[model samples]
Target: MALEGAAAPGVAARRGLGMFVVMIGVLISAVDGTIVVLALPAIQDDLAMSLSSVTWVVVSYLLVVTVLATQVGRLGDMYGRVRMYQAGFLVFVIGSLLCALAWNAAAIIAFRIVEGVGAALIAANSGAIISELYPPAERGRAYGFNAFGWSVGSVLGVLLGGVIVTYVSWRWIFWINLPIGALALVLAVRVLRDRGERVRRRLDPVGMITLGLGLFGVLWAMTGLAAQPWGGTQLAFLLGGAAMLVAFVLIERRQAEPTLDLSLFRIPAVTPSLLASLLQGLASFAVLFLVIMYLQGPRGLSPIDASLLMLPGYVVGAAVGPFAGRLADRWGPVLPATAGLAVSAVALVVFALMTTTSSLWLPAIGNVVIMIGGSLFYPANSSAVMKASPPGRLGIASGVLRTFASIGMVFSFTTAILVAADSVPRSTAFAIFVGSTTLDGPLAVAFTDGLSTAFFTMMGVMALAAVLSAFRGRAGSPQRRPDGRAGGQVPA
Candidate 1:
């Protein structure tokens, strides 16, 4: 019950240190998410990349992480989570170094893929690692700190990306990760220890290959559709990817140790928690891109200036996350998680109401509203999933959670560009997104209208997320223990 010991001397201190190290991992991943976006134009100019190719600098990392998260998490379950996590740090550092030294477009994209593998390893296991260290009662608070890492990292990425891209070289962006990662890697080795039981399951090569290739095919098509008009190629990839995914499901059902532990969904709380995360991600991830497009496209703000507008929200959200997580720990996940989604949906409504002539403060206020909602949702949703997961399957649960969230993120990226392009020329819409071009006059008005449409669409998605969150049952109830009992209470 509750991971071996609570009264042991020095264990609590070690756990605290371990959690701190894990937060740093979350920080690095979050920083990378936004940092690269601001530097894309400079990278394009320096490397003489075509418009389409520059976007891959961002897409490649997301794609690789999305594809490999579950498989790597399985590795964590088979080996040691701590061992794989340390390896993630090493590989990420090396990939960043390669990125800093990259000479051409193709090289940087390839290096980003390398970086993504490390990221997948880290992202896939961080939750399970936390679960191994902390018990259910405290996981919400721990995840709150995790969200805090994300908030601070998002803010840092924007500020650092802007400052470095303007005054320094874009290469420094990748270089910046080096010192942070190195320190974290050393700390990870010294501070974190594997406390969970290991499963000696055979690797599912068929499931891995099918899932990876399937996701890649669909993602490649979606990213392509975002940059250019849809065609037969996109349709073909979509259908082929769907078919492969179906085959993956069929294969998983027959396997002894399936890559995805589909049985996890049988728990009452698990399915809703995972679905809520995916839907929340689908609805919310693109808001950053959409708002940036709004500021850069119609309002003609520079990248740095636009990012600054969103900074206060991240600041407020970071501060609020721990408190909301405390509420989750006390009240169960359903309340705060669903309430957060409702709050975020309200913010989307506000965003949808904006226009070219609307006050700039409109979006600033909405950003604060949405980030607060996000702070509430992410930690609770995560806590719910991990809390319900059995000790032995924590890695699988964590991996599936990352996989769902990554899928949402990838789709949200494509949805933002494709939906906004409806009101402008496709190339023009893509240019506005990447900060290479700005719109004015009628084009600006039309593009703003498109942004409103996209906002409304996402708002609906958030509503569905709220509904799913509400259905997660009582999160404060006892979770299943390793001894086939509910928490510490034994059956009569």
Candidate 2:
């Protein structure tokens, strides 16, 4: 069944509020993610953390969120999306407070895990909520606004971190989230009145456990590689993680209600859109980390300034979101998504060509182009995933989409470590990544060479993604139905 009590296009005001609240939710997560990168050096100093422990501060959160995404979205399907989503805000606020007050490395990692649970809930459900709220004809527009929130939050992460960390305490970064979360939670309560219908399905404990452990093992090994070289421990973790993932696929096929409905891949739109999301995340996030490290270590820029060089991309991307979404609503996802990937490749090529003496304008211009490409790609792709999903399984579909999206990011962490370790000592590269130190002379040249290799490699990955985007068949577009309605009932 379709979600109960969804807002129609005529109710512009309520829909606007609905969009506003969710976008704010998006902003909260994005800000927290980017702001922490700037604050990591401070946290390391304050807690006297080892390099591995400091890395865990970020890795722990990503691992938890990635693991819990599908499960939480399934819960949203069974209970209520808005109810679960609101609860995420409350949990995140508490986590943020605890993190602000943490006295040691262990405490911070524990608090971050708590926060990740909340973030998982939020990320898994945001797209579903948007699908439920807006009619298919206007979903792209709503999602575009959602992208705006991400852009604004990322921009603030850089701009605010520069000012706050330089002048105020790094602890304030966590504390600042309290008010934001509180406000978002209250607004969500007021705006999200529609409750989705409950689906009667048993939780897939085996699937969840296997999938979670598989991810945890792989992600942990990747993070560990940042501090050390390939060894027995890393090999064991990688092989074990791969085995668990294989088991998850096999087990899922036998379960009546799997943690993820593997059958969803049969939908032509779903497969390509999900792949596009995954590839895009891998390419973009790796570049983001690589670029920041380059500016910070080799060029000796502050964390904020290094981040600022990429600001144009985020800002311009946000500006492009709604427009691209509108075009997707009118045309379809294939053109926009393919074009986005192609443009990103061009951006990466620009980065590959840059030199130590190159103007900051080179990076800035490339970033803006990359953002424009992403702005074009993201909303349309997300909307396409939702469009291809059946109404009854929107939550699962959204969850699966988020899972696919995050996969690239998790892999990007591995990619970042592998690439950075090639040019400099793993520890030194990691410290530079977190804004703790700088590089000079031969070391800087080596790091920049590694950066060039990574960028060119990413360009190739994006080009491949563009090909997949082009092949994602049109199945469930707004105009696809014979009755000339805004949506068609997707078959299970």
Candidate 3:
């Protein structure tokens, strides 16, 4: 039998099936992104990699995804989103199988790049597909449900990664994706229908190449800067990356159909929402990464234990997001966005004060606060971007928004690595693992202090985000909706 949302006659069942298919793809892709963190040590042991090299395992995935996200979104618009979505699932499954069979770190990282590319395609189009499936009135609810997949996936990644690593080999972490991915692909093909007309525009080869290379350079430099000396190969990469990025900007300005529509920056609502997303990413992504390390590395918590500790925070946030989206629908984006950022800033401060000797409640409380803040902002920010974008350009706008968020994540990770590298000794990286497992001695103090510093930096970043969020379009502005409806005005 065909899934619910297939082009079959049954409307209700088809819609439900379509939503499920989309959410499965979303959750799995997101879970894969973070699940590897808990498995990092296992991977290192298996491959005999240095701490710095191990980081590339994560960085490679992120960099490839971030760079290609916008391009893939555009491709979805030119082709059909359903087609792209199915292709993404197939590619991701192939990548997962490659990762599971990898013999070394280099091979795994290479395979992860393939996975990242697939992930980018899926992420860039998931929301666009949801919007196509649901009417405007119900779209908010549908998007809220989609966001839950992201939040739950993050938590599941940590929890499942722990479980898999504890009982199974690290390779199982990747192997797990195959069956789920295949299921998603089958459901998607059976449910989601092709919607858009295939446009036959020439691909902007120069624009695509420049943008990809520029992003790769920047992300590469950011990831490597901390591990390599300032005057060495890292610095050269940074400079080269920056120069290429400059060339990209210049090239894009002259292109008739640039991969990225630079003109979108001119839109009043789009600019603030994009900037807010970027800042939110910079401030928040590193916070979670460091927290996982702190809990599993220095606090002597097992992977499962640490995942459980973080459960409350993610649950609270995910629960509140739908309500926050409703509030945005009524009040406007500014109040919720500003309030969320403020809450996040406060949470970061609390998080910064946490030491090994501090009560566990402190960190838990801080995490909850940050999640609450994020849930408030995310849906609202997304709504604003959709409202501001033209209907014909929804896919492009989504791409831009996602690209900014991905870039923010890259920056956050890079910053965390740089800061942690300075605070923790390269040789004693294993000490962190030992202290985390034992949780009983002076080594715990050192590990906690390093974490505290990392949290402090994250707090500073969140505070900066708060300041920027306040500048989001004034309350109660008559924002233009993609559907040209005044009833969708953003509240001041």
lDDT of 2 by residue, 1-492 (tens): 123345455466777788898998899898988888788888999999997788778878877787778888888888888888999999999999999999999999999999999999898988899998887777887788888888889888878877777889888989999999999999989888656678876788899889878987787777777679889998899889999999999999999988778888899789988888889888887677777788888889987678777787888888888888887777767788789889999999998876677787888888898988888888889988988888888889998888887778878767787788878999898888878889889888888888899999899889988999988878765564565445553332
TM-score of each model, in listed order: 0.94, 0.95, 0.89
The ten-residue window of minimal lDDT in model 2 covers 1-10
Show where candidate 1 strays beyond 4 Å.
1-9, 475-492
For model 2 the local lDDT of residue 355 reads: 64
Cα lDDT tens digits for candidate 3, 1-492: 112243556776778789889889878976897688778878888887766677778878887777777778778788877888889999999999999998887998999999988888888887677667754434555666666776777777867887987888989989889989999999899888886655543356787677677777767776565655565676777778888889888988888767677777777767877888888898888777777667766666777777678778877877877787666665566677778888998898888887776777877888899988988888777766666665556667777788889888888887776666565564454334322244446766766677777777777767777676677664333345667533444443
User: Local error of candidate 3 at 8, Å?
Assistant: 15
Q: What is the lDDT of residue 32 in candidate 2?
A: 89
lDDT of candidate 2 at residue 410, scale 0 to 100: 73
At residue 236, candidate 1 shows an lDDT of 93
Q: How does model 1 score by TM-score? A: 0.94
Q: Which pairs of residues collide in candidate 2?
A: none
Per-residue error (Å), model 1, residue 81? 0.8
